[model samples]
Target: MAIRNPMYCGKIFIEKYKDEDCHLVKGLHEPLITETMYYEVQDILDGKKRKSKLTIMSPSMLPLRGFLNCNRCNRVLCGSASKGRGNYYYYYHCSSKCGYRKKAEEINKAFVDELKLYILNDESKEFFKTAIMDAYIDATKGETKDKTNWIVEITELGNRITKARELLLTGDLDGSDYKTIKTESEHRIAVLEAKLSEAPVVAVSPAEVERLLDKAIVKLTQIDVIYSNHDTYVQREVIGSMYPEKFTFENLQHRTANVDFLFQLIYQINSTLREKKRRASDRKTCLPIVAPEAGLEPATL
Candidate 1:
């Protein structure tokens, strides 16, 4: 009762408790503890709070534990080891009452196969690298101009604040009006200063950019190889980058997984190019260029 009482934190109710006419007085006595700590204890007694410490995953197993969704209930799957015949077996299962489950070995193999689908071929890798470099160049083209503009605006706002101060000193502007102008100008200057701070000190060199792109391309092209050779942490990172959203496993395969946008773009372009090349070698059989019907319709008014 004392743990739930506010009087322990130096508060007192003078009138009827919790009544509209009740008057509550705080600091009636010296507090033995802070009000925050007292309320937190009350919350625990009421079962309204729990420990906020994060539960760490096993670093050597079940890399896809929270990433996999149960096919039946769509809840994030949990993994655990089960003992049978004096041997331990691992499985990913749903916490819900749906009773969905799968062997960890099977699910892990399926995810590795899924990664193989996004691996870029040699031609696609080169094209993807070039496209990314070109886009980066175009994006950085106006970066210098942006920094200059932000710096100019910040300087102008600072001058405005100074002018407002001068007006207030001379009594040309009312104190309230001068204060308003100063506050607004200062806010604008702060925003512009933040943007200037984020700007790079020097432009990146083309050679340096190319070197980075080459390394990234290699990673993208050999993603499965890297995932297979890495530890659980790296494997989880690969899964996260490939599928930002949780995916379901059914029929011994991953289903409804959303590939990352960059990987999707690379896969789409490569597939389209392959289709075009295939059609070019057999143009007569392909009828995508022709209209649906044999007869032509009348012109619209």
Candidate 2:
């Protein structure tokens, strides 16, 4: 939910690269969060962070209960209802004293409306699908560079790990310090090793890509409908697939996703579409799309 990366606090970040611990040390960049402020933020986040409640509730009107949290204090919303004249009115309130409350119906409708932003028409959808398929298959052909980088990373981690153990044995570094570096180095090694051990990805055929894109287009177009039809738990699961972190909700609106690259790509395409206009004679318009991580090769068509 929060990115309190220690690198922003005037720290050189590496597990076993520096002589000291992996935490903040003197760095060239200006610190964003002071040591005191960093600790306070950590305490607050640690205290507030909690696993989403998984208890399956029976048929209920408030299906978006645990899917949203308090925008102010990051607390799971509590849903309740009160009998008003003949019908019951439902609302979601923050557990903390944030004075934040919104009608359940409004939140649910707003969330569904928000999901509509991802829907793309036939042309744009096909363009992105082709770009993605090309990138995926292209990655498989020239993977030697990636494999070499992984091998170098694994070798560095191994060397650091060996040095850390020798320092601990020679009494140059204390057991606690050695353990910290060792754990960090081991984690890095394990991750790289797993990647190295995996079978190489075989490129999908042209027909397969077509079928995959057809299925994807169906899913993309029906995202909102699928989300609306599901129960609260399943709805949240759909949201979690796209947004791994908990998003903020305030002023009767859900916050925009910042970390999800898929959403970012969609936004860029939509923005380009909005900025361009034709003479109404030629309907074809081209938008340049780029994603370095997904094979930086840009597409313009």
Candidate 3:
């Protein structure tokens, strides 16, 4: 009986195996390749070494990532990973032909620092608070109940329910009929209750705005740390909330600062900062970039 290499007994068997009786060998010579290399070869053959087609998303980072746009091409910057010498690195890159790429850490730090500075200043901080309050109020503007309409509807539903109950009590209607009417009335009441529950309670008051602003300021001050380690999704959410516009970079030869909606806000907050920074000095100073002016109004919610 021919002794067989155990590794070759299964899928590795040769064409002649069917014609011969094979016996497993008790002892075999050392492997031709190191264990590590053998595994690597197997992985390659099995397509295990192939790059994954899955997208990576970090929920914590969504607050900051999606809002940034490419200064060169005006395209939304997207997160991507690349394999370097022996490790992978993540970066935000412009998807357009301009191909602007920056390390995610670098871009996030620079932007967050700028945001923090804007938020920390008294004038800008106040303006930011007002803007946020305005946004909240606008979001909840239509939630107030039309009392007359609701009263009428509720009364009709109540009467129907009462009639159904009376029919059941007096035996004027069969069990099935009573049940059907009662169920319909109960469903109507439930629907109205749900609508009331969903309605906005009230606009955030001025006092509440002050409290919220304080919290936002604290978070903004630590934005560098928050953004650096935050998940991609949270980073994106922060950015989207801010609604950054395309940054227009000028005087590239001298490394002029990129101009965008947020930059405009910074300028409004501190005009002197632009004067001292010659790079962005040429850009026209505009009014505080409002949500409406920037066309960043949320779609009708």
lDDT of 2 at 89: 88
Candidate lDDT scores, in order, read: 0.80, 0.70, 0.58
Off by over 4 Å in 3: 1-73, 94-106, 121-202, 244-301
- Per-residue C-alpha lDDT of model 3 across residues 32-116, encoded as one tens digit per residue: 4454554565676678897447755543422334555677777777776788999877777778889788776666556665555
State model 2's lDDT.
Answer: 0.70
Global Cα lDDT for candidate 3: 0.58
Between prediction 1 and prediction 3, the one with superior lDDT is 1
TM-score of 1: 0.56
- The candidate maximizing lDDT is 1
Per-residue lDDT of 1-301 in model 2, one digit per residue for the tens?
A: 4456765566665666557665446788898877776666677678864444677662356766766678778888888898999999898878787888988778767766766776655556866776677776677646656778989998998899899889888999999998899899889889888987794755566678779778877777677778778776767666666665655555326446443666556656655665564433245433334533544665443
> Clash totals for all models, in order?
0, 0, 26
Candidate that beats the other on lDDT, 2 or 3, i.e. the better one: 2
Where does the lowest 10-residue lDDT sum fall in candidate 2? 279-288
Segments of candidate 1 deviating more than 4 angstroms? 1-61, 85-87, 147-206, 250-255, 280-301
Task: State the lDDT of candidate 1 residue by residue for 1-301, as single tens digits.
Answer: 6667778778776776464576657865798878888879888788899856876754455888888889898889999989999988889999999999888888888887767767887868777887788877787768877988888888888888888889888989999998899889888888888878887765577789999888888888888888989888888888888877888876326345787888887777688778888888788666566455544785333
Candidate 3 C-alpha error for residue 252, in Å: 12
